[model samples]
Target: MAAETSDQYETLQIQYPPSHRRGPLPLPPVSRWALGSVLAVGTGGFLVLGAALAALVTLYVQGQAELREARTELLAAGAPLLPPNSPRSPGETPAAAQRRKDQLGRWLQGLALGWRYHQGSIYFFSSERKRWDDAQLACRASHAHLTSITSAEEQEYLARESRGGTYWIGLVATGPGGSWHWVDGSSYSSAQSFWAAGQPDNSDHGEWGRESCAQIHPVGNSLWNDHNCNFTFFWICKRDLSGP
Candidate 1:
């Protein structure tokens, strides 16, 4: 009985290998809850990173659009990057705000040339020729009048620009036979006289009986001669507005 029992015990021990003998596993105890917590945290971090990237992309697109719009507006106004007297408001992006300010600055710079301000009368010299009456009528139509030489400087300017052409002036004779007067009714009291030798003779048959017009010649000096009103010459027209 003892031998049989020993053999049975040995067989039972052989069947259950020592390595397979069950007890506590050969690893340290692990908390399932802690492991799950770690996994959750890693997943949460990945999601957060993805969301942040998405937000950044959206913001970048919006910024680019706003910049494009600002550029277009500036170009349309023929304005520089900035303008004057521009105000900044809340919620404006940095680029958009800067663009508006630049446009304002440009406007200020052009104020002197009537770009953003009202300029006074402007004057121009016409190279076209017309009769005395026709010239006067043209000036009236253009909201201007024939220039009246009020000073020596003015006469000199006209003389230089006219280049010796017999230009019409605001002077005419009003007498029945030989009386002459300026359009402003001023008598011929200029200290500076620019007459050719043996002028005002009224000798020729060409309006000699009724010579009543002023002619300026480009004789390198601001000299003028009185002639008949019917003579045609290129005239200058002065406007009432200022130009650059």
Candidate 2:
């Protein structure tokens, strides 16, 4: 009976594989080192994937911020995202918003105040108390001088713009009723005199005698009056380059 029992046990042991043996079994290797290596490889792959995803996210955010800054600059320069006739609101679809922004950006590039290439000449207008000498000195510091109306066209243009205010011109009589000369040493012969009636009287004010300065005042008709230079009035300034 004992021999039969031993033989049966050996037969049962042959049917089942030993724990250390491996074949086409569903279970993996039981070695802790092997298991740890596999787990480490899996963790490393996961970390690499996480890093890639994080980089993608950062790039997306930076691109979005740059686009927003460009849009804001376009809007601040008096450019609107949508035209008055557009049938879209701020709450509209993404397509509509993008279209509006593009349209406005194109329009802003064509504005006159957008940018200037060159400025003509510097002109000045002042209300502060300054003698003719002082005024000329101030203009020189700015690399400019009192205005000189060189032609009839310029005179007419100035008369129209000056309106009714008395402003200084470059023409001044060095000697009583002498040849009028510009501050830049140019003769006044080129100018078409649009002086007001009874101008340059040079009335004696007891202190400095008659007025030595030349001024322009546009009455009902667009004409200028040579007044005392001592009078304070807002002057017009011209820049060799275009103005702001």
lDDT of each: 0.53, 0.54
| Strongest candidate by lDDT | 2
Number of clashing residue pairs in every model? Answer: 20, 19
How close to the true structure is residue 165 of candidate 2, measured as C-alpha lDDT? 63
TM-scores of the candidates in the order shown: 0.43, 0.44
Off by over 4 Å in 1: 1-122, 184-193, 206-209, 239-244
* Cα-based lDDT at residue 68, candidate 2: 52
Per residue, candidate 2 scores C-alpha lDDT tens digits across 123-226 of 35565535555567766665556777766776666676666665666677777545577786555662356665655455543453455667665453645445
Report the C-alpha lDDT of model 1 over 32-112, residue by residue, as the tens digit: 998899999999999999999998887666545544454455466543443334555566676767755654433333222
- Most accurate candidate by TM-score: 2
